[model samples]
Target: MQKSVVVLAVLAALAVLSSAARAATDAPAELDLLLRGGTVYTGDSNEPVVGDVGIVGDRIVFAGRKAPAQFSARRTIDATGMVVAPGFIDAHTHANADLHSTDPRKRLNIPFLTQGVTTAVIGNDGFGGFDIAAQTQRLRSAPVGTNVAMYVGFGPVRIDQLGEANRAPTPEQLDAMRQHVSRAMCDGALGLSTGLFYPPQNFSKTEEVIELAKVAARHGGLYDSHIRDESMYNIGLKGSIEEVIRIGHEARLPVHVAHIKALGVDVQGQSGDIIRRIEKERAAGLDITADHYPWTASSTRFSAALVPPWAVDGGREAMLKRFDDAAVQERLRTGMRENLRLRGGPETILFSAGSTKYVGKTLADVAKASSADPVDAAIAVLRDGDLMIASFNQSDEDVRAFMKRPWVMTSSDSSLGHPRAYGTFARKYDQYVVKEHTISLGQFIRSSSSLTADTLGLKQRGHLRPGYYADVVVFDPARYAAKATYTQPALLSEGVVTVLVNGRLAVDAGKPTGVGAGQPLLRTPKAGSCT
Candidate 1:
């Protein structure tokens, strides 16, 4: 009886094992999409791996190595001979103009999508709106083409309480500003962004900035700044760097420098010193990072570039009043003349907006055409209306220096009339990686994608890994190049063959699919902080 029972138990165990084997053989192998045979940069390494990526729903199911034979894909893209990478993330941009536009086509963000930029950080240079919740709601109501992250701008917060006055805030005004920043943090801002280089903000003292930064720190946000000086404007570049570092130390939050550059001739060779200082600070355990645009020319308002901040103290009307005063005229012109010199002369400043006659002309060209002094021509253009200029003041050496740094990621301070808006990523790839060989393709991809995402605290969005969002780009490296020029600033880049945003095809065969698949990426406030 015992022998018979043991034999029966053995038979039952065999039966159970056979059933499990059958179940394994019958398990489904299906995927929503497959990208096959591409040289993939997973954004975590400097080496490219040839592999297939499988996706289902909005997340990657598999990356690297071939998918199993049992898995069948609904659609497979033949990515042979192409480079597959995590979709590029623009660390800084002014694409909010299009993102907020009433027109659906503008909201498509075709320019950015074509360049393989799947995400854009808005509210840069301290011009971001205070009502982040309203902005998020607007994005929900009207979808856009690329994902957007927002910063609570220092400009708006200060201007909300203090008008465009060039004075320090009072104690009560300071408290109000802190409350505004705190509210914005609760509304899902990634950080507090300040354009200390710009007026009104430049007028603010360092202590005031630290106080506001503390509010963001308490709610787990960072501090992103267009530093007080990139050149010898007021505080030298080194001084400005120290200021932001001090803010990070005192406020206890990560700090990011926007459009990092040694602008103008005065600070051209200072990149080495700047890098050392930043590296030292990083070693000391402060979270410090920066972003850079490839172009040598930086864009900004014509007035902001040349006019003395004091002249614009009260606002445009006051600046105009100063312009009309003969007593102030000599002082203003002297300041303007020196400022123009510091920017490498009128020939380097090209007007890109606000006047049809001067839109395509340099300050030198405009002055020559009008038969007036360059400074006078600049003033005349300003009086007509504030114009945007592509100021070609950065040195190639300094640009290359900053580009190679691991801590410095890529960005496009995108604005109208600047080719950077349409072609920053493409241009960087073509000039720095493909042509100059300043950085390897893997380095470029990693910096533009994962490094930026990590610095900004964006989770699970920058790597081509299993369980990550399927925001990916496949491009022909040989053919990828920027077509936009300084004159024709809106031309779309070439060579991005396919783009997937949140697992949906936003671009196919180099054309925008008009798919508004973008979602507003909101940073969740620290636990219990919002309440």
Candidate 2:
């Protein structure tokens, strides 16, 4: 009896241990989502293959041919016949400026999301806000549909330190500007951006830009510029590119040209010249890259396109006063005539916004109707608030040449007047990749996603790999294309059936899910750097 009792107790203990082991083995891996049977574009690789991607919380937990056997997901998607890729990162945008709109639709950024863009780098062309911390925090205050990153603008910083003054900064003022740049870098600015093509920043000489860029360089940040001129505005096309190269050489930081293009009648076929200079500098081990919109036409304010930089020296109020000054009117007219000629004439400058009567009319048409010179008509239009223009001045050959270059990535340079604001990525894919065959599919994916992320130093959100942020896009290859035009700038794109920002669904089944999962992307300063 004693022997039997001991055997029974041993069996009971064995049973208890077996139950505990089973319980531990059966515990769920708890993945948030799983995407199966999609042709994945890994972004880094040149070819895509069938694969599965798994997400847990805000990170991609698995991305390979085989799914994790242990994990049980709350949501599973059959992405068969779709292209699963990293969501696009727009390298240049003004989206951050519109985040404060009371309209929820604008804040949702559906135009961006539907095109498969997951993030936008704002404050381009030296118009980024002054307080980096405040702007970043404001994004958090009211969540946006797309992730936001910023560059501290030289224009705003210069204007803030010295109010639209048309001269070089004094030593004391230079110190103050440096302090501002440093503060912005500390507050998570990616780098310094200059709109040297615009006022205030236009007043700053190349040496001044180099000095400001050095502050960003110390923090391991980039130097991005709408160069001193894309055409014959001030320094001319080749000279502007040389200035950028000089800045990169002197500052010892990566220099990115915002909206790389050969604009106007004088610079029509100069894309090759620009490319050669960049390639030569790159071979010398200086980092230089550029972003280009797919469109041949460029968009901006009419004042920016037609008005002489000297006339806008003291800001809008001063500009209006100059318009009225009888003494300066003739000079202004002469300057405007020259500027108009550079922009491929008034017929190329189509008004897109600010006046209903002229919305779809070219400056030539408006000028004809008013029975006035196109230059005077342009100046008159500027008097009635800011006018947005679509200047169709570039050559298809120039655009294609630039697009074929590897260093040139895709960007929107998006704003209110242009269809590019709503359709850049989709248009690039549809026209360049699918329709025109200007570049391969893999190259298109890289330019839109990983390359842009790499260029901007967005560390965790570019590739569809394990341990990266789960910002992903799944689109039907056959159905994806841009629908927005200059007139219908708000139309959403098709084909991006689903999008996730930080593992949360922002778009589902080709519709917005009303989840604002985007967060501010701050730069990770390289080791031994100030940021």
Candidate 3:
């Protein structure tokens, strides 16, 4: 009788197993993850809501209701009473460090993910990012909280080949640069990045830009530029737009205007013209897109501000020597006047980086404290210490108008640019979308997530859809806000409670779980790869 009962139990277990197999064949297993009960903002404009998002392995398995019980995992997160959206993508960043410092506690990163940034495009402003073999190796084994895609920086290539001398490349030199660009792209550069506002790259003629961009095009690369001038003053807004459009037309590649803004007091309201020009370019069939941080202030080194381009003509050491020369100092003043009248006024220059003592103070404030002239204070600061400074120059009206443009994907334009670095996403969602109601939450998420992903051609990310990476964020709209201010710029954003990247728990209950599961945006092998 005992044997008969055991036999019956085995038969029942077999039936249950058969039923489970049937369910697996019919629907996805319950899932390794099941983030349900939240209002899923999928970042898909067409169908935004989903009953649940389920994950199997590293991929999103299901994104609908009534998931099967087959998905059994060791853990699950209940995202109830929150908005589940795609993780934020910072389209522009500068995370170049000469040294990683080799100390975990002394590590300099990990604040990005805390602010809902799952991925960041590092290497901008013609910075030195060409060490792809090294950077790729580093990030491949990195412990950072987010994914990073790098661009082959033009300045790094120029600096490595030719010191920061202002001149166009020779034919052989141009070819060499192309080879470097191609190899970097092969090594995994998503695109070619240029900073027309900086030295070396700024000296490259429009034709030179097109030549490199064509190389980028041959490698399925996009051209992103910090244009010659963003302000509608002297250089004129159309000249810069013309340059990007010219690049697109010549290279037959997509061109992105990095951090589109109208600077300077006189040109503050000319954002509409910039938008019209961009639209015209887009209408003409050249793939033209732009990214802008949801902030008024743009940050850069103070040298770029007070000191003229001529002073920075050679490199760092050259500038220090020039600073000590009285005759050179006089020339520097002439250039500073041009920059002030051209770049923006003193009110726009906010001290974001450098000594903690100078963090919140502006050039005017520094002058007041030092009992010196404002421009002289700027020069002294550069000469004395690191000149990391933020320019609070953009117009709020221009910012709002630019944000409303559908083609304009939002970016931080920041890696360590104070409040914007830590609080751009939250600031937009809270102040603009939630608190102020300038844009809807769905629209905000779309621009922050899906649009950016689509803009970059990074498939399977930037959305909470089935078969996509489970890079997700959960936050309460009412509670969502950025706490980092100009005074306390290091503060993290408030109200985002959960962030997940690649189906793993990266952020649990508003804190990092210390799991870094980021993946590179795979560069597809196409005709472009061959170039």
Best by lDDT: 1
Q: Considering lDDT, which of the candidate structures 1 and 2 is the better prediction for this target?
A: 1
Q: Give candidate 2 regions above 4 Å deviation.
A: 1-28, 526-531
Task: List residue ranges in candidate 1 displaced over 4 A.
Answer: 1-25
Model 2 scores a C-alpha lDDT of 0.86
TM-score of 1: 0.95
- Give the lowest summed-lDDT range of ten residues in model 3: 98-107
lDDT of 2 by residue, 1-531 (tens): 653343344334334545446345544455678888899998879699898888877777667565635456789999999999998999999887566567766777778899999998998999887599998877888878999899999988898878997988899999898988988888889999999988878998888888889999999999999988999988899999999999999999999998889899999999888888899999989999999999988998888888898999999999999999999988999988998999889889988877886898999998999999887788788888778889998999999898888888889998877899888989998998999998988898898898889888998778997668889999999989999887787777898988999888999999999888888998866566652
Judge candidate 1 at residue 165 and give its lDDT. 95
Which candidate do you rate higher for lDDT, 1 or 3? 1
Q: Estimate, for each residue in 363-438, the C-alpha lDDT of model 1 and write its tens digit.
A: 8998998999998888888889998999999999999999999999999999999999999999999999999999
For residues 360-383, could you state the per-residue lDDT of candidate 3 as single tens digits? 777778788889876777777877
Better of 2 and 3 by lDDT: 2
Q: Rank the candidates by lDDT, best first.
A: 1, 2, 3
Ranking by TM-score: 1, 2, 3
Question: What's the C-alpha lDDT at position 397 in model 3?
Answer: 88
